[model samples]
Target: MLWVKSLHIIFVVAWFAGLFYLPRIFVNLAMETEAASRQRLLLMARKLFRFMTLLAVPAIVFGLWLFLGYGIGKGPGQGWMHAKLALVLVLIGYHHGCGVLLRKFERGVNTRSHVFYRWFNELPVLVLAAVVILVVVKPF
Candidate 1:
């Protein structure tokens, strides 16, 4: 269980790192006027998204193992766990949203501004903060 927890943390951290950077790349992509630079940023976004998705899989798997196998959050007074799970779902949606945005950029159809991506990049930071607080403080 401890090992699983460690792996979960590791993968989650790795995934979040990608989540954090990908949008910044998007910010660059949105602002970049040069074709070569745009292509490079697109390639970076593609690779990062793929790697992040790989990390997310084991992170989710170990998280489920903790929830179901180890019973990390069961029964009464576990509202924090439920909240955390909801936020996790939101994070998943945000991850998918990133992919959607990436595809838009790839298609040369991205209409959003760098400022928009600047704001978009902040979502994961806020989610990560809330999740850490939920896990560590268990604030229900």
Candidate 2:
């Protein structure tokens, strides 16, 4: 059980690392001027996004396992846990949104800009803060 929890934490941290870095990649990619440079940036962003998605699956599954196995629901009203869960879902939505936007980029749509990427980069940090607070403090 402790091992599972540790694995879950490790994978979650990896996933968050990817989440935080992916948007920074987007920001850099958005700033590239030359066509070849932009294409290279796009390829890097695509690969990073794909890796994040791959990491996300096990993170989510292990998180669920921890929640159920640890009997979080058996404790006092888990308002903080609920909040964290909601925020996580929002983060998942953001992940999928990035995927969609990346597909558009691959299709030569050019929808996102540096400003957009900068703003998007902040979201994971906020979500990660919220989740860490909720998990660590569990304040009602």
Candidate 3:
């Protein structure tokens, strides 16, 4: 169980590392004007999207092992766990959204400004905070 928990934390951190940086890459990608630089950024973002996406699978799997298998938050007064799960779902949606935007960037069809991506980049921070607080404090 301890090993599972440790692995869960490791993968979650790995996944969030990508979640945090991918949009920053988008910010740079949006701001970049040189054709060669844009292509380079495109390649970086594509590979990162793939790598980080692969990380998410183990992260989610370990998380499920902790939640459903270990029952970390299944007892009474676990409403906070429910909220945490909801946030996780939203975070997953955000991940998918990043992929969609990444595809747009790949095709040179991005519509949003760098500023929009800068703001978008802050989203996972908020989600991470809420999730950590819910897990650590269990504040329902």
Model 3 residue 46 CA deviation (Å) reads 0.6
Give lDDT tens digits, candidate 3, residues 1-140: 99999998998999999999999999999899999999999899999999999999999999899899989889899999999999999989999999999999988899899999999999999999999999999987
Compose the digit string of candidate 2's lDDT tens values, residues 24-140: 877877777788987887888888888989888988888788788787634677888778889989989999988887787777776678899899889989888888888888888
lDDT of each: 0.96, 0.83, 0.94
Give the TM-score comparing model 2 with the true structure, all chains together: 0.92
Model 1 gets an lDDT of: 0.96
TM-score of 1: 0.99
TM-scores for every predicted model: 0.99, 0.92, 0.97
Candidate order, lDDT descending: 1, 3, 2
Candidate 2 lDDT score at position 91: 88
Candidate 3, residue 68: lDDT: 93
**49: Cα error in model 2, Å:** 1.1
The sequence of per-residue lDDT tens digits that candidate 1 reaches over residues 34-131 is 99999999999999999999999999999999999999988899999999999999999999999999999999999999999999999999999999
Cα error, candidate 1, residue 108 (Å): 0.3
lDDT of 3: 0.94
